[model samples]
Target: MSANDPGHINDLSKDQEESLKNFWISIIDKITNKNKISLEDFYDSTYGNELFNLFASDNPDVVLLRRLRARKWNVNLALEQLINTLEWRFQWGVNQLVAKGESELSYQEILTGKTFYIGYDRFGRPINYISVKNHIKGQFPSETTEKLTVLSMEIGRKLLHCPVESVTLIFDMTEFSMKNMDYQHTYFLFNLLQNYYPESLGLALIVNAPWIFNRCWYIIKRWLDPVVENKVHFINNIDELTKFIDLSNIPKHLNGNKPDFNYIPPTEQDNIMLSAFQNDFSGNKKARENHQQASINYLRITYQWAQTNHNKDLLEQRKKAMEQLRDAYEQLIPYITTRTHYHRYGLIEEPIFYKTYQRIQQENQQESVHF
Candidate 1:
């Protein structure tokens, strides 16, 4: 569809998203059923399924399914969008986009705490704060918004040790004005967050929005589906935000002085889910550092006589092994995105997948299960 498609946002129905769940169980089954070699076996197992092999997992299947939901379970459309984003990542070499520290030079320019990820809330959801006035129009690079947003999310995932799958965005529009509100950038950001990155934003608390923001948001809200529109809220100040997220995780710069509680975990959330992402960040970073040297050693290897000679079959086996190693070393962003889009995919009843999803559907029956 063209940019001018009027029903672009609403064309995909919410019901469609809720009906496609086990493809998820199938995904998990696919990962676990690989040959008993090692953790490296996961990639080869993934490749066995043609539907999955079409694109590499820059992020986990949880996030991949979100894109699918965004397109109402239309796998082809969702895959196309996913591939476009992946192609962008490959071209930019953004797969290596690591936030070294809060002060890391790579992304520090965007980490002025203006649109920065502070920490996780009580529910283990990452809480991001965006100071609109600090955002000077045309000041940063063209991809500044995109890069900063993605980095914030990646860093958020690293910081969150719990099984939280989504993020809570705080748009602090304290000094909001036409001058500070970059219309072009705002338009671009909306499309990126809504169309490109879906099922990731859990809540959007728009605080201190000026009259102009409300006017603009009014028009924008009309285009949004109710599921998204309902998440957007207008708040007066920081005090109001405390209801959804505890004040402890809020930054000191944002009038959050007492950092006593870590958003006091919900009474019912004592036994929170813990996703694999919590432990993978540091290991992934270290792997990237030595990855080049490792590649050199591989290239310098002397092959067997059969492979070196005219044996096509032997050479092909060698090539497959090489690809598996390369793929194994490549890092993918660990994710357990929002479970609201979960569906049973009632078509197939493969026993293993059915059992896994049966537990999942039960866990997520009453509410959206984290991770």
Candidate 2:
């Protein structure tokens, strides 16, 4: 064979090409049982085949077949089905790439005991196919809440135990719905997490809808304290949120106290004691702390009371009340800092945080690379 000859390396003759095409046709026919299948069935059975053939062929019938196949099916429907299949395959391929990347990255991070924030969707759906694929491959935290809580706890544990100072708790709130939001639905939902764990360094609540941000604020503020209000944040887009997260001094604020339970801070000691006694600790430590702190920090808050001549005994009572106020903090501090009481009361088991973190990180990386 000449050095430049194309025939040198197992080049197929015309007859062989014809025979191979016949063989493939026979295989396809056998697969379809030689049945006269409808265009829908053809597209369904052999996805994008007709389309591919039409693109490759000079025959008019192939183009006609595509149009005929698309008649009963709306453009969107046909397009959607084809796109779904393509997307699925693309996702699968992307997932494989992610798996390799994650194995390398996760192994390194785990070995080094490094803390990294992995963002996840609300359902703990893999943010990327690779994470999803690896999760499916490794069978990590199967349930959504379990996965998220486990992720949270893993990061929390790492922060608590390792040299890592903090962890990023990233979540996209685009699909979050207050109407469908349930506290106990999953083992590690957002609200349940707020109740169960301390607020992390910061939270990235990705809100594409402005109204959703308001709703999320309500749900989060229900459990977190005013101090940690800065920790909870809202962003209109992922890019904005990510940028803000990097800046580290993004502005955040409380949703403001509810009007129904609104009360002015007590000015006198007697009032503070009465307020403390009547204060509701219905939610978690964060809520209770907000109430307690609001009461103590603003001891001079004015409230309407029947004006009466000041009495000496009443003044002493106020002094005693002030003493009681000082004592309450000593008691409340431990309660707030100790293990969350609700966590023991049928709160879901500790979630698999590290696996979730790894899964999310892999997913995000896959998405960035693929889509």
Candidate 3:
């Protein structure tokens, strides 16, 4: 490739870089505003209040709603604060779990508090006291380095309490590889907990490696049979994880009681709203078509309301009309791309195309001046 070719150089001109940055900032700002407004409107609705109460409790929803309102007004700063809060809460939970002597295998050992050493073998399997101690020294400090560690553990504890004879713990192997012990420590603890404390509760922890999931479908099916399928708890985050364990009624579950809430199904309206949100401004032509059809259907329903209630206030009807217009605009923006059309037709691939054309025009003017 020629040295002057745009692709050959990694750096952009100062003005070009500034233009790109500004474009990205504008897009982020627009998305942030839309996200905040949608979330706020949802929260203010009756169904939103009910959902919030079910998840966060009655008292905390007030605080959460206030934060959410602030986020609607100042989205970027609120998101940063939210991240910090979650991180702090997660660390606090881990500290509490460790302090409760829940980390140790034996209750008697915890009570005695002897300076016992543990060791591991070549494969990092727990071998003896001395080796385990060495492994802990090497890996324990930053072992569970996830934002949702406490919630993940709580889900594990709940799944262990299930009435079924055995349970399978499935995790993303790609994520597991980032950790120090390569998930060996977690596997060992799961097996140990199953064997020593709750012998009846058979535990099988499976790491679903990237390619393995696609190739080993039969193996996964064999493991998830009638015996273990009901007890199995698949977890990606703490919020979705409440399906496996009930945090509110923890003591009852520990004392051999079954969990109260089995699962929460997504409401039909919520599903529709989510589907609308996903396909709203998707770059794909097919997605835009689907969203347009959905918007048409919604408009038809609202139009019927307008017709049936002749006495209904004019302002209410106008408000609904405005919402429909906004939805129409959302559906249309994806299709109208003048700049992208030029690029697709091989007109230009770089911002320098404009600059080069402008420079050529300037040189011709200088030659004309000489003439």
Best by lDDT: 1
* The best candidate in terms of TM-score: 1
The positional error of residue 107 in candidate 2, measured at the CA in angstroms, is 21
All models: lDDT? 0.50, 0.32, 0.32
Model 1 reaches what TM-score against the true structure? Answer: 0.53
Whole-model lDDT, model 3: 0.32
lDDT of 3 by residue, 1-371 (tens): 11122311133354433333333243233433645644324333333322222222112212222223334324354444433443443444433342222222233322221112112112222111111111332333333322123323332332221122222332323332222232444443443332222222232223224443434434444433343334443334434433333334221212213232121233454344334333434334543354444434433343344334243554365455545544543333223211221122232233332443344457658969999
For 38-92, candidate 1 gives per-residue lDDT tens digits of 2233333423222232222222334555676577777667656665654555464
Q: Once model 2 is optimally superposed onto the true structure by TM-score, how far is the C-alpha of residue 120 displaced, in angstroms?
A: 13
Which runs in model 3 stand beyond 4 Å of their true positions? 1-168, 174-184, 199-208, 211-371
Q: List the candidates' TM-scores in order.
A: 0.53, 0.25, 0.18
Error of 2 at 137 (Å): 25
